[model samples]
Target: MSIMDASGLPATTPDSNQYSAIPTTPSFPPPSRRVSYVASPSLTSLASQLPSNLGRSRQVHDLVRALGLLQDEEQEGQGGRDGDEGRASSPPRATILPPLKVGRKEIGRFHDLDYVDALLSPKTVVSPTNSPTSSPSSSSQSSSDDEEESDSSSSPKRKRFKPDPTPTSNLSRKLLSLQKFGLLDDSPPFPSLAPYVLALAGAALRAAQSVKDGTSDVALCWDGGRHHGRREAASGFCYINDAVLVILSLLQQRISIPNPPLSDPQEEDDRPEKTRKPRILYLDFDVHHGDGVANAFLSPLSLPHPTSSTTTSTSSKPLPGTPQVVTLSIHHHAVGFFPSSSLSSLTAIDTPHPHTLSLPLQVGASASSLKRVWEDCVEKVRESWKPDWVVVCCGVDGMAGDGKGVWNLGASEEEGELGWCVRKVVDWKGGIRGKVLLGGGGYNHPNAARAFANFTSIALGRPPLDPRTPIPEEGIADEDWESFAPSFDLEVPVGNMRDLNSSDYLDDVCQTFAVLAERIRTI
Candidate 1:
C-alpha cells in the first residue's frame, strides 16, 4: 500500500542523505512569529544540574543544534543602562526567562499548592558554580534558593512544622521534600529533575502567554510532554506534568500568585485576573495515553458535569470551569499497556464523557487505522465543541522500532497527522487561531529527532523532506553525533505493522464517538 501525506496526496520519498538547509532562513525571522519555539536556555546550561548527576539527553541537544533551531544572542540581546555604552556593546550570554511568579501561578492553576511546593522546594546539589571546569560556561543556576541538599541527621535540623500526617499537610512537607530531593535510588523521587521539568513548563507557559497576547500563533515545546504524570504523583519518568500546566496556563490567560502553607509562603498578588477560558481541543497522538492532561480538565475539580445524553435547560447555571477543554487521545491500547485501568475503561463504556475522548486502538495499529481515527475525531470535535485553541502531544513512539511502542506509523504518516491537525486549527472559521505542539514519548532518539524536524518543516510551511533522503551522519555534531551514526543513515527501512483491528471494533469506536459528539452538544 502506498503511504499518504496529511493532504491525502502521495508522498514521494526524497534522497535520505541530503539535509534541506534553509539558507535564507533568518537567525530569527519576524514572520515566523506565527510559530514560536519554546526552548529554555537551561536545556544546555543546566545539563549537569541534576542532583543524581543525570542531565538532558546529549543526542537531542546535538540534533537540535544541527537543525539550526537554536536562537542567536542577537535575537535575545539585552538593552544597556542609561549611559553605559560598553554594556550596550557587550551582549548577555543568558536567555531572559519569563518571570518566576508567572510560572508558579500557572503550575498552581492545575496542581495543588502542596504538590507544587513539594516540587519547588527540592534543591539540586549541582549548580553552575559546581559544574565541571571543562564544561562550557553557562548562565544556568542550580536552584533559585541557596539551600543545599543536606541530611538532617548530620546537619542542623531545619525549622519543622507541627505534625499533620496527611500528604497535603505542612508536616508531610519535610518528608516529601526529602523524598523528592534526596538520593535518586531512594523512593525514585528524582527531585533533581524538577528544575528541567519546570524550565520546559515555564517556557511553554511563556509561549502560551505570547500566543494569547497575539505575539505568536504557534508554540513548539520540543521537550515538554511528560503525559503520564498525575496531579499527586509522577510516573513514566515525569515528575511535574508540564502539559497540564501549559493547558491551564493558556486557559486562564494569566499567571496566578503562589500562596502555600507547605513552604516559604509568598505574598499573593493577582496581576492578571482570570480571563474567559478558551475552548481547547487537546490532541494526544502519543502511543501511550495522556492520562494526566485527560484527568486534569475532565475531573470534578475542573468539570463537575458529566456528558449528558440530553441538552441542559437554558435556565441551569454552568459549573465552575464548565465546558472544560475537550481532550482526545489516540494511542495503542491493550490489557498490558502502562497505566491501563482508567484508559481501558473508556473503551469499555458504550458512551464515554465528551470531555475525555479516548481512541484506544488495538496493538499493531497501522497508518491507515490512525488516519481513520484522526478523521473521525476531528469531525466530531468540529461538529461539537469547535475548540478555540489546539494543543497536540506529538509523540512518535507509534513509529516502527520504537523501544516502547508497538504500532507501525512511519515518519510520513506522523508528519501528515500533525500537518493536517495544524492546518485545520489555523483554518478554523472563527477568529480563534492558536496551537501549541509538544514532544512526548519517542524512545528511538534519532527517529524522534527526524520526526520533530519534519514537523517543524510543516509548521514553517516548507516542503516536506523526502523520506528516502538520508541524514548525513557526519558534520552533525562531534563525538556524540558519531556514536549514533548508524541510526542516522537514511537506508533503514520502516516496518509496516498491519492494522489488527476488526471492522466490528471500528464500528463500535465510531458509535462511541457519535455518542460523545451528541453528549458534548448538551454542554
Candidate 2:
C-alpha cells in the first residue's frame, strides 16, 4: 500500500526491499536544513544491553524502519512540507549516520577523572580490607527491574552476568566502590558496561556535531538522552549524562551575528567584533525532573543583573551577563518524586540560579495543561533567551499507559499533545539555528517505540502517522507480536486519570514565569 505524498503525488509504498543496509556515514555538505538520524548496529546492540531499557533501542529502530521514514533522499521527491502552506521548501529526507566512539578526554570534560576511570575500566577492584559488609542487592530492587526482560539477548561479543548478591572479600570491596559512585541500587554494573556507555554517548555527540557543523538542522539520537547520569555518580538508570555532554559541545560553538545598528552613528568607529558565545536551551519533557542536567549547570552567578548595569551591549542584543546555557524542566513533582532535589521546584524570582528553571505540575496533567505551560512558560523563555540551539530530552514516560507516569499526555497530532510540542520546537523561527532530540525514560517498550516512530516522522517533514495505523508484520518476529496486544496500532491512547491542575494553579504558574521571563530579558 502506497500513501500520498504531501504534494498530492503518489509516494513509494512499504516493500520488503526497502529494508536495505543503512548507508555509510558521508561527508556532509553545507546545511540544507536536513534531518539526520544517528544509529549503528553496534550502537543499537550495545544500547539494548542497558538493564533499564533492554531491547528498547532496537524496538524503536525497527518501528522507524517499518514506517519507511528512513528512505533515501534520492528515492522520494522533497515535496512534503511542514507548518504553513506558503513554506514551499521542505527538509531533505532523513538520513542515517554512523557515530564515532566518545574518547576518555571528552568524557572527562564534565566528570571527575577518578569517576571516569572507574566507569571505563574493565574491572574496578578495591582492597579486601576496605570491603563493606552489605552487598548492592541488599537495597530495594529498582523499579525498572520489575519489567519482564525481553526475549532478545545482548550482543554476541559480550556475556551478561548479574551482580553477585552475596559478595565475599574482594568482591564486597568492589560493591562498596560501585555504591560510592551511585551505580548500585537502580543502576548496577552489567557486562560490557564500558562499551555501552561509549556507544550511547557517541551517538549523542554525533548528533550534536551534525548540527554544529551544518550537516543538519535537526538531529535525532533515539539511543541517547541519559539525563539522570551525574558528574561523579549514576542515578535513575542513567550511566552517562548524554544531555549534559551535548549541551557542553554546543556551548563551545560561538554564534556569529552582524553588528546591530549603532545607537549613535558617531560610535561606529569604536565598535568591537560582533560575536557572542552560543546560547543553548535544554528543554526536558520527562515525567521526572531533570535533576542531573540542572545540577550540572547550576550556578549561583546566574542571578538577574541590575537594571542600571550595561557591561557591553549597546544594542538590543542579550547582555554579556546572561548565562550561556539555560535549562527548563517540566515534570510531575510531588512530595516524594523519585528525584527529590530542591532544583526541581518552581523557579522563584530571587532564586540563586534564575536561568535554571523548573515548572512542576500536579498529577494527571493533560494536553491542555501542557499547552498552557508551552504558551506561557516555554515560548516566553525561548523568545527572551533567543537560543541558538535547542537540546530536547523527549522522554515518553509521561505518555498515558506508562506504569510509572502520572500525566495523561498522549502522542497524537492534536494541539497540545506530545507530538505537537515537539513540532513547535522543530518549526520554531527567529534565532534557533539547530535542534537535537534525545530519548529518555519510557518503560512500556511498545508504546515507547510507537511514540518515537511518530516523532521521527515529524522530523522528516512528514505528517504524523495515523494513530490507528496497523503494526506492520514484515519484519516483526512471530513471538513478539503479542507485545502489541489488543490494539496493535500506533496510538498511545490517553487514560482516564483526572487532571488536577486547577485554573488557579495554572494562573499562578503563568504569573510566576512572567516575572522570570522579564528577568531573563534584562540579563
Candidate 3:
C-alpha cells in the first residue's frame, strides 16, 4: 500500500537500513513491526481549537515532532549529517496517514441519525422558546420601551436592539435541537464542529482499517478515544463515539486459529481448527469510567455461575452464543463522580453481562496499585479470552498533577508506569494479531503531550526519553511557550498523594477476579 503524508500526496518510502544514533532498549514486538500513525494538520488544528481542549492537540503534535518521531528517514539522515544537536535517536519511522473523510453513513453507524443531522447541518436552528424572556421579540419590545422612556427623560439617546445573524425562527429551533442532542454546556458546538467530528472519527477509522488490512501490526490515533459519546447524546466532552465505531468495524472481519492446548492431551488431538467470529477486547485505562462504551455492548445474558454445570462448554469453541466484543474499563469510581452510573461500580461483575467489566480504583492510586491490578485481573482475563484484537484507551488523566485526576501514575519506563503497561500489551502472544492505541482524557496539556510522546517512542520500539529531557522549541509557537514554564521538561513525576489502594483492597480484587476468570474459561 502507498504511504501518504499530511498533504494527502504520496510520500517517498524511507530506506529501511538507516538507523539513528539514539540508543534503544530491547522491548516487545521488536523494531521491525510496522506501525502507522493517523494524523494531519486539519485534524490537529480542528481538535485543538475546541474550547474544552484548547491547544492540547497542537501541543501533542508539536512535542511528537520535536522528538523527531515524525521525521522521515531522509530528514533524520540530513539532521545527523548536519550535526543537529537536538535530534533524539530515531526509532523505526512510522508511516504518516492523513485522516480519512467520514460521512453521515459512517457516523450513523454508532450515533443517532437525527443527532448527527443537528451536528452537521448548517441550517439547524436553536429554539428560543426554552428561554422566552431572551427571545428576539421580547428583546426588541424591551428595547422600544427603553427608547420611549429615554425620550421622555432628559437623555435624548435611545437604546436599540441588535439583530441576530440568524432568523429568530431558525435560531430557536436550532437551540432546541442542540439541547436535545446534549451539546449545550461542556460539548457545545464550535465554529469547526463539523470538521472536528469528521477528522477525529475518520482518524480512528483509518487506524482500525490499517490493522484490519494487515498493513500495520499496530496503529496509533492520538485524537480518537472519545469514549463518553452516547448513541444519541454527547457527554464528558466526547462528541463522537470513535472507540465504539472501531470495535464495530473490527467485529465484521473473521480469523481462524488453532485451539489452545487442552489439559487433556487426548482431547486436544481430537479437536479440529474452526472458523469463528473475531473477538475484540476493548480495554480502557482512562481515569473516568467508559460508561458510553460499556453501555453500548452490555448484553442481556448474565454470566453463568461457576458451580453451574450447564455453563461449562464441552468443547474448546466459544459457547453457542457468546458476544464477540468484551469491554474492560479500569477507572476511578466514587459516589459523586462526574458520571453517576451503576455500571461504573465493581458490582458490574455480579450483573448479567460478564463481558462488560469494571475495575474501580480508589483515589490516589499509584503505579504499584495499577501493577497489581494488571498482573492479577487484566492478565488473567486476557489468558482466558484470548482476544484477536486489543484496543487500549491510554488516557493520561490519572497521571499525577492532573487537575481532574487524583491518582499518582507516572509516564516513565519503570515497571508499573504507563509506558510499562503499553509495552506489555504490544508484546501479547495469545492469538493476538493487531493492536490499536487511542487517546482519552488528559487535562494537563503539557503532560498529555509528554505521555503520548513517550508512548510513541515505546510503540516504535525506541528508547524511552528521560523524564528530564528538555522541551525543544522547534514546533511550539512563541505565544504558547509560556505554558511549559517552571519545569520546561518532559517529566510527569509522581506526586505526594498517598496511594489508598491498600493490600487488603488489592487482595479482594484478586479473589473476585479469580472466580470470574474461571467462568470466562468455560464461556
Candidate 4:
C-alpha cells in the first residue's frame, strides 16, 4: 500500500521525474472507423509462449481471435458506405489504438522493479536433501548393512525421488510467481505468461491515452482488468493490476508532468483542450471486490469521524484542484467466497474509507437488489464525483448460472445490468467520451463472450435489439462459437433471480450508503 506518485513513477528519488518522463503518444485510427482494438499477428507468437492445453492462455487466444475477426467484418461492411450512410448503418465506437508492447519502464510505473523481475525471471533452487547427487551418511549405511541381511528377504525396494528437468529460462517458470503468492498450489501448464500480461496492460494504456488526446472518446481493452494485484503480491488470479496502471497513464496526460525531453512542447501545446487534471470515476462490476484498486486510492485516517470534526476538517483543509480518483465496486459480499479474506467481505462496509465505496451484496442477490444499489449508491457517487474520465471493470461472473458465482441475476437481467451501467457512465461523461472498458473475472467463458459482445455494442451507442429480429448469421457460423453467440434473438427472456434481499440486509445497504455518502462529501 505505497502511494504511487501522480506520474506513476517510483517515489524513491527526489527528482526521478527528470530522468523518467517519456512523451509517448498513442497512435489511434480514425474516429469514423468501427471499433479500434489491440490484437495483432504477434498474438499467435504470444499464445505460443504457453502450452496449448493451458486454460487461461487458451481463453486469451480465443478472445483475441474472436474480437479481431468481428472488427474486420464490421470494418469491411463500413468501408462500402460513406459519411451519412455509414453513420446511419454502423454503430458508434471509439477509434482503435495501434497495438503496443510495454517495455520494462512502462511496467515499472505501477510495480516494483524487483517484483517485475521476479515475474519475468523466476528460478527454482533445490537443496542438498532434495538433490539426487547427495548420499546417506556412512554411519547410517553401516548400521543398515547389519540389519539388511535379515530384512532383505521380506523388505521391498523403494524408488528414488527424481527431480523433474529444471527449466533454465523465466518463461518456463512463470507460474512459480503465482505459487509464491499462494494463489496457486502448483505450477500450471502455462509458463510463458509474461507476454499476455504485458499485452493486456498495453491495450488498457492505449485506450486511456487515446481518450486523453481526444481522438477516441472511449477505448475497450477486453483483456485487461486484473484488479487484485498488489505492489508486491498477487491474489484472486491477478498478477498485475492493469486497471491501476491505466488510471495512472490517464492521469499522466493531465498532470503537470516534468522532463518532457525538453523538446516535446508541441505535444503539450496540441492538447490545449485540457486545462486541468481530468476527474476519474472507476467502477468494478465483478463478483469480487476491487481491493487492489481500492488500496491504491487509500489515505491514512481519511475515513469518517464520530464527532463533527468530519465537517470541520473538510472545511479547514483546502481541497486540491484535481479530484482524487473515485472507485466503486458492486459485487457479492457472501461469506467464504474465493476472495473472502479481502475487502469483499461484509465487514468491509463498517470501516471508514475515502475516495472509494464497496457495495457488497448477499448471496442470491437478484436484479432488483443490484438495480437499487446502482441507483441509490452508485449513481449518487457518480453525480458527486462528476468524472471527466471513467474506467469500468466489467466482469460477467455476476451473471446467473456462473459456476464461480452465487448471484442469481438471470441472463437477460445480467445483460441489462451491464448495458445500464455502461450507458449511465458514458452519458455521465457526455456521449462517446472519456470511457475505458476493461474485462475482469468471468469464469464462465461462453457467457462472458456473449456478455462482452453485447456490451461492446452498447459502447458504440447502438439501440436495443428487437425480440423479433433474427440472430446475426455471423454470430453462429460455427459450432465452436455457438456459446458466444446465442441461437435465439437478443431479446430472449430470462426471469429475475431468486430474491435474497431480506429487510435487514436492505437496511444494512442503506446504512452503508449513508456512511459512504458522508465520507465522500468530506472529500
lDDT of 4 by residue, 1-523 (tens): 1223342222234211111111112332223323444434343234324221123323333433333223343343342113354345333433334446686678778887776666555242223332222245411211122221224465553323222235453422433443454324222213446665566667667777767776555577766778887777666667678899988887765533243353655564443332456567889988888888888766455444445454435363335432458888888775566565465544344355546677788877776777777777777777666666789998778876577877766334243365666666555643224778887877765556556656665555555433344433331223324444455334423445666778688777767776666556655
User: Predictions ranked by TM-score, top down?
Assistant: 3, 2, 4, 1
Query: TM-scores of all models?
Result: 0.68, 0.80, 0.81, 0.70
Report the poorest 10 consecutive residues by lDDT, candidate 4: 15-24
Tell me, by TM-score, which candidate is best.
Answer: 3
Better of 2 and 3 by TM-score: 3
Residues 1-523 of candidate 3: C-alpha lDDT, one tens digit per residue: 1233563322323212221122333332324566777877667777886768887886786677667666454543332122344333334556666777789999999899988887787654223432323444534433222222245667655343233334356444555566668877567777778878888889889999989998778899999889999999988899888999889888878887678888977763766677769989999999999999999998876656646546556677776567888888999999898678888888433456678888999999999999999999999989988899999899999999899987999988888888889888887877788999999999999889999989987887766778888887655654444677778898888889999999999898887777676667677
CA shift at 380, candidate 3, in angstroms? 0.8
**217-285: candidate 1 lDDT, tens digit per residue:** 666666677777677655665666777877776677533334434443575654444434467878888
**Candidates' C-alpha lDDT:** 0.56, 0.76, 0.76, 0.56
lDDT of 4: 0.56
Alpha carbon lDDT at 160, candidate 2: 25
Q: Please list all clashing residue pairs in model 1, or write none if there are none.
A: 14-466, 14-469, 15-469, 16-468, 16-469, 16-470, 17-469, 17-470
Q: What TM-score would candidate 4 get against the native?
A: 0.70
TM-score, model 1 to reference? 0.68
RMSD of each: 15.1, 9.3, 8.7, 12.7
- The regions of model 3 sitting more than 4 angstroms off are 1-30, 73-90, 124-172, 257-274, 308-311
Task: For each of the candidates, give the backbone clash count.
Answer: 8, 0, 15, 2
